[model samples]
Target: MKLLKGLWIGFWSGLILGLLLKWIQSVTGEQVYTLLLNVDFVPVIGSVQWSEITEFIFHMIIALVIGVVFVYVAKRRNYSFGQLVLISLLMSAPFPFLYFLLSWLAVEAEVPAATDWSAFLYWIFAHLTYALLLPILYKTFERKNAVSQ
Candidate 1:
């Protein structure tokens, strides 16, 4: 049940995050969305021409993994709403830095350059947005789980 809740939250949050990043990129001409969906650095996966939907599914799969782990920890620790939010934010803090690694690894990919301050800021914003959703969605699902259980 907990796992199912986590998956639900992850699906919605990830969808929103992907759409938000794509929208931001469209409006501002930033490549943060490109970074979000880029798996071109992977040995075999990178070689395949993935459509936008496939890339989004890959992104959602990552979010689902994080969600399950996050919910499990939150339930175990009995974290307050504030704690959940804080932990989610902290967990996401390192994500923006991944852009640097991605830039280096996926040289042929159309992601933001390692030194692009503006794109980094946009990435930070997108991540923070996603982090905020985690706790809220978790709380919502917790209520439903409690009722159903």
Candidate 2:
């Protein structure tokens, strides 16, 4: 039961977050913030233009793993909403941050010059946004879980 709830929350939260980030970039007319969007991974893989779909699924899987872990941990510790949010950010930020580092390092990467500051901030904001949403999702479903009990 708990595992199912975790998967539900994680999958949706990650999908929503990924979609939201993509939408923001589109709306802002900004250069791609996500490295995968700009990477020439095709020649390496040969004929696979499924980059967008693959990235989403990869991130969703990551979120699912985090969600499952969070639920199991919460079962023992019972963190408050704020603590959970912090934990979520802590768990979520590193993966993207590492990407940001790689993007910064990759000389051949078509990264935005503004990414040095602005896009990096948005990257942080995006992760923080994900963290904020996950707990809210948890609390919402938690209410449902409680009432059903």
Instruction: lDDT for model 1, please.
Output: 0.88
How well is each residue in 11-74 modelled by candidate 2, as lDDT tens digits? 8788777877787677764444465344344356324455678756766887898777777766
Give the distance in Å from residue 109's predicted Cα in candidate 1 to where it truly belongs.
2.0
Clashing residue pairs, candidate 1? none
Give one digit per residue, the lDDT tens place, for model 1 in 77-97: 788999999989887878877
- Model 2: what TM-score? 0.77
Q: In candidate 2, how many clashes are counted?
A: 0
TM-score of 1: 0.93
Off by over 4 Å in 2: 36-48, 93-96, 104-115
Candidate 1 regions exceeding 4 Å error are: 145-149
